[model samples]
Target chain A: MADFSTDAARALAGPVWLSDRRAYAAAEFASMPPPDATDEEWRYSAIQEFDLSEFALLSDVRGAEATPSGMGDNVLGDAGAVIRTANGRISSIEVDDELAAAGVYVGPLAASGQGSAQLGAVSADATDYFTVLNDAFAVEPLLIHVPAGVVLRKPIVVTHHLSGNRGAAFPRLVVHVGADAQAEVLDYHTSAQGSLLACPVTELDVASAGRLSYLNVQQLGTETWQFSSHLARAERDASLTASTAAFGGGYARTRSDVRLVGRGANCDLLALYFGDGNQGLDFRTYQDHVAPDTTSNLLYKGVVSDAARSIYTGLIRVRPEARGTNAFQTNRNLKLGDKAWVESVPNLEIENNDVRCSHASAVGPVDTEQQFYLESRGVRSSEAERLIVAGFLEEVLESLPVAAVRETLRHQIDAKLSQHVEHVEHVELDELVENTELGGG
Target chain B: MSTLVIEGLRARVGGQDILKGVDLSMASGEVHAVMGPNGSGKSTLAYVLAGHPNFEVLGGSVRLDDLELLDLPAWERAQAGLFLAMQYPTEVPGVALRDLLRVSVSTSNDASEIEAAMRQEAKRIGFGEKFLERSLNVDLSGGEMKRNETLQLGVLRPRFAIIDEIDSGLDFDALRMVSARVEAATKEHNMGALVITHYSRVFEQLKPDTVHVFYGGRIQQTGGADLAQELEDTGYRRWSNENG
Candidate 1:
């Protein structure tokens, strides 16, 4: 096996030149040390749960094409989508030509080379190590650009395929929504059997008066490892909404940052995760408002079973200039087994007295009364527990952008519930059933 | 005929004995009103029969339609044809009223034509289309909760029901609405009902065929509508011999 250092180095080798942006990023990443548990930002975070040697760069992606691990039609591999990385090469992407002609662009990081020059303008200085490492070693990333006043009816889906060996794969995506434009972008990551490491960084910019919705579904195998970061900026009168779900993973951490710099801008964030059996899922988020009249609302829910563990830390920050800002954050957790654990901290920092801000969090076991009620209805104990857990995750599910994705999410959640507990005969719940009583708008 | 027999039924709450030895019975197509003064065991019998967890059954036997009701759970007992219109309904937030009703009905009956049928039945019960859209009793008016309860009775079509003080906190129009739902469901479904009330106004509207006087935790007397009218006139003071 190649030395871990050399292997990490080989992935960063590009033509050396005077410009040298790629080389410079790699040198800093190699020079930087890993994050320590003592960092207050990393409290309760199991940093040691991550190791470099156990993973290898995912070279073969054939397995992902067989079936992306979702339940139904609302998943990857649809016609309008591309499975390039899952094919083990930077293959061709076939976008609906009409969409491309409408000023919408979707492609890999290298394919985004046309606008690769502008990415530097918003790129961070790499003050930390993990952020810089992703910059140095990523396969062709996804780039989406929507022109002004354009609104696309269909959402763009990006599928990242990673194979075995627990090697880290850097997956990055950059989104630019022009002024007064509306667009929805989705990122889906899947891994084959065996352990693997997938590191991802996504950056989004919503221009003045623009509206953008972003969603990410990470359904890696139980033996896979992952770390992800999302940084977003909203300009004047621009609005953004984002949702995330993690149905599978061995150990994972996702961090998101939202910066509101324009007056009258808004951002809404939601996340839901299902963790089971030796799984540890971590989530960190920040909602920072620097301009006046900015607002953001965040809600996250987690359902944990077996020996699974989860941690959530979210904050709402209002700078002094951000007067009249309103922000709210809440996290709820449901424990299906005693071995299941959750830690949630929803906090706020308001320097502006004119702003209205609130934060709340709760972590508890499945409500005994609710479970018994469903069981008494002949739903069976496991099915009853699943319904109660689903109820706890409904708010997060509500924010999912597509119908197929929502159904797949619910199906995967039900399957996970069954796997975590024995004798869990899956019973379809009536509430999730579609009906006019469910009343279509 | 479906028969409900309660023998020496005793219950307690917070370690205090509420029902000493309450015994009563009713056959199918009959509505029995258990009338008593305030603080009597009228509502306790409703809860005890439905098998609510908090109200402990100290010593009792409750058989619904010849099945041991006390041995089963609350929701299961309902599936076995016993419905309780609770005096105070539990508030379930974020659960839409329509969704709750549909799920409750579907899970109990597993009917294929339920979705369309519920829509048609919802309108006839005087609950407008919007009633299903709202959350289950959350932010609902008193009249709305009672109407929703009756709507459950209509849709679930239980063989036996216990209407617990459906008259309390209701205006004239709301009281008649509750009574009308109970009356309509009983008349249409061959249902046997035990309407528990502290005030005689609900019985006046329901016009129960049988009346049982509950005083000091026991059924002291049983008769026809004359007993309800007599209690309404004498106010249970003449039966003060068993008064606490």
Candidate 2:
């Protein structure tokens, strides 16, 4: 597909170490077969219809042009740094003087020289086919490193703007929070106009007693296909919160894996996704507890209207040595149109009897009781459904670790509902009423 | 004064007739108490008037003065000045009471004014602003839910209110407070109210202008406020045989 040759990977202008690694990954990726729906990992995915030959790699060089106006403007008032990329090229990078003086580095991983060594440290063990592809052709990986005991009071914002016609971009980000440090990072993925492919990989490494908050917001064009990988590891007494908000993409899939490597580590994983039109959003998550007294909680909520569909499969695993581990997983979905559908599956596997684990999932249409409650209060039926769906997703949106993005995300959700509410009114109420009888209150 | 007239109101739910040719009329600033035993269609009447989707109206005419309320949807009926305080308020998670009240009182476009008005009502009802900011009816005690309903009634100030079994779960003090709020709303807004209940204790504070005995889906007796105490004293045994 599109000649992903090792020679081509070796031709890019980069450090010798990076070029050699890309060449090796390209060779490995070539030998691997493309994933399909038959594989359990790709179950319910649209991988079979994905055509890699439709796109060609654009470049390996980072851009230095001004970010297009309104492309990725700061929603948060103050930021420690702002990095902007266009079509896999770095448009600009701005770091606060104080942050830089505190030994915090935000720039190209390759420019960091020795710091580039930590690029794949956290995600190496969780590599899949797409991740391997990302390694082979990723134009330039961004790195944000906070040294020991340096707490960046403001968040670091990274915006990736994709404007390609039948082209592909591989964006990678690596974040390292040193021991006893604290950091918050926000990544925005957006596109202008083009049928494109994006394979992104993010790695988060939090050291002992460190705290990190990370959020990824994807608002790509509807003609794009996105396969993203999120890998995170927490050490002793560390805390990590990772959240994702997916609103646009023809077929978008996110695979998240979180590992508690040391005792007393804690993590919170949250996601909010809304699919309208013909969109398909799929999610797969794994929470692995390898040490004692570790805790992980996951909550994912989604809404699908028109002919859109969604699938969520999550698992909580407690290893034999992980005693006194507390794990909880929940996935809830709402289908506003009769043609819309959802599939939610949650599982738990605990090897230690001392562990506490629970899993819950629900998939159904909007609650008629809730609709009636709002209607009885003088809200029109269409407006009632809109409010209910918005309120349903508000739980996860409000809980986003980044307080600044919460209101913007909520307004985006309302905008989506306002456009689709009229279509929802055309949905057969009788069908929804029947679904109401089958659904839980 | 405005009048609400209901004539030959017939309705059924799930293939069972719950309202059978009932007739009644009331005016603004007047309060009527509908008392009966359980399963006597007291709640069915309230729901039918509110145009709940579950009920099928076989034949009826409900008019608020000259407006035909039976022809409109529930929300339009509400916009036309009708309010029903449901017995079991549905819990809508993530929707705050203040936001809901802001939407219900559609006349005011200024959100801060509505918020201030709601805050005043919340204070009068002994509810804090934080409580108003919480999800509507979620995790609320029975007394709190009833109080929340009273607060909405106060803010909405509808012309007519059909309160269904508001005293079921309230303690003595809560019942007294809720009834006093309803009385104040009636005096302030010239609101007409039809209070439905199985017990007579609520009337001790509400002081209804008239009382009607509901049985077999129709009103069997009409009298002054003493009618509630008579039924509470003797029970609804006499009206039980009317279905035959």
Candidate 3:
């Protein structure tokens, strides 16, 4: 309806050399209609309110060279490589010589032409409006490939920064860990304060006996709207631990689909989201177990305060052929304000009787027992509540692979807590104090 | 003289009176044991003193060294040198024991001295480094939880302490170990204590200066340490039947 045709896709692709891929994806996007609230996948989302015609797909920015403010430093400390993109265009790429000598490729996806295979591999199975749109217009895609048996000691950090207003950006990243390889990758998304749209897609392919640790930190501007999709596939004996920290964005939604396709493959999915001040944070996850003895554990925790809202719906599906699969899904939400709302739905679809699957969900305020416990230890009521909330989120934060990034996320959570405490009423000391003249003298 | 004074304290849970007109007083460096049968308001007294919201104080006056504790919040009372070793210490997930101890001690002591004292006290309580790093009271044994509470007492060194049922659910050796630590803390800080228990065994290890028999939410009788042995031999049936 918004006229995202082949010619427009070419224009949005800018000077990128992936014309054929862009054209093919553009034709696909043109044939498919935009998702509405009626679609099962788009339920409980503000998809009906989304107007693709409101924002322009700008291929260039004026201040693309300037480093955006609030971009975290040393996010991937001691990284083997760093690739940065601004306004959907590659700004810089650097790789360690030792890693490069071991056949590790870290550079632009379009330049190497290695991303097309994995790029559409995931979205092809279950296409979404945003994924098709991203495939059609993603100008500069980043790639990180760790070759067979190459165990890189350091991670590969990728930063995507948006700088202009009233524009839409499509950022893509493809990660491939070869057989017996191990690696970690971190992606940071930040932008200047303005109304913008960001649709980012990340695809991870873990080969047999490979291990990958991936982290996505979304710190977009307060006025920005982000819709991100992440897909990961783990092969035989492969393990994938994918985590996300969503702190910023006016209306942010992330859908992650992880598939364990081979025997004994394992995946652990962890996510933390905090929304404040009329914001909305939504997440939909699918853990598809297709092979025997495969396991997936998912834990997602979030806090909503002010007039903010959050929704989490996750499903763990065990196929009929997948016996002896052990899968667990947990989603916990803390509503700090009376007006704040959260909806958590954890579902299990197990076709195999031999599989073990359990799902748990909770949405409520902080535990009063935890609050009183802290208050009894000389912590003030406000500080006590803060400590409880922090402690509630600490498990996921500490599980982060990078200490520096974890520290940064902790600081962000603290800042949000401080701001939230100002607008809410905590347990009062005067109220708890006993009256002196109630009983007879 | 520094003292903890509770005069005509009355409290109720959900409109049912639990601590009815309770009176107690103890000076610094004094150890007083309160033995009572189940449902006699022993734990309620400790919780009301700690400002637990579940217990509504109908009327009371609690003071520690001229500071009116009844008018203060739990944290303020704690800041004014009052401590409570709960009968059931809450299980706070993701909060390490070391972190809780550091914060609790820093409220009344120097920040720089917390880590060293924390490590020392943790080791003194037979807690390994891993135990100190584990979540507070999570997956801890009954004895370990009691020891952790005693460790907090050592860290805070309050002017007064209320330990409720610290000896319950502990084996003989664990009971001895925990009682020894509680005794050491009270003596080292020169603090007054109100030890609430159902058994006289803990009093034997603590060697309390006084023992009080509690029934019907009030102290029915008060006597020297021998009272503990008398109650142990006779049981609480005598006082409970008289009060009922």
Q: How many clashes (backbone N, Cα, C below 3 Å) per candidate?
A: 9, 2, 0
Error of 2 at A48 (Å): 1.3
**What are the per-residue Cα lDDT tens digits for candidate 1 across B1-244?**
6888999899998899999998887888789898888877787777778776778888879887568988987767877877888776655444554555445554555545565566666666567768776655668777777877777777667788888889876889878877977877778878888898877788656879988888888888999988887887778886776564
Candidate 2 chain B: 10-residue stretch with minimal lDDT: B100-109
Check candidate 2 and list the clashing pairs: A63-A89, A63-A90
* lDDT (Cα atoms) of all candidates against the true structure: 0.74, 0.87, 0.85
The per-model DockQ list reads 0.31, 0.69, 0.70
Model 1 alpha-carbon miss at residue B146, Å: 2.8
Chain A TM-score of candidate 3 vs. true chain A: 0.93
| Model 2 accuracy (lDDT, Cα) | 0.87
- The 10 consecutive residues of candidate 3 chain A with the worst lDDT sum are A427-436
- Using lDDT as the measure, the top candidate is 2
Q: Label model 2 with its docking quality class.
A: medium
The superposed Cα distance between candidate 2 and the true structure at residue A328, in angstroms, equals 1.0
- For candidate 1, the per-residue lDDT at A264 reads 98
Tens-place lDDT digits, model 1, residues A1-441: 422353454545343331255556677766777777788677777786666656655555544564465636645443344434562334457687778788677775454445565453344722355666666666455678888998877777777777756466777677889999988877777877687777887888899999988888889888877778878889999999877898777888888788899999999898999998888899999999899999999888888887889999988889999999999898888887678889898888889899989899988987655554443333444545555676667667877765457877878877786686552232234444545456773
My TM-score estimates for the predictions, one after another, are 0.88, 0.94, 0.94
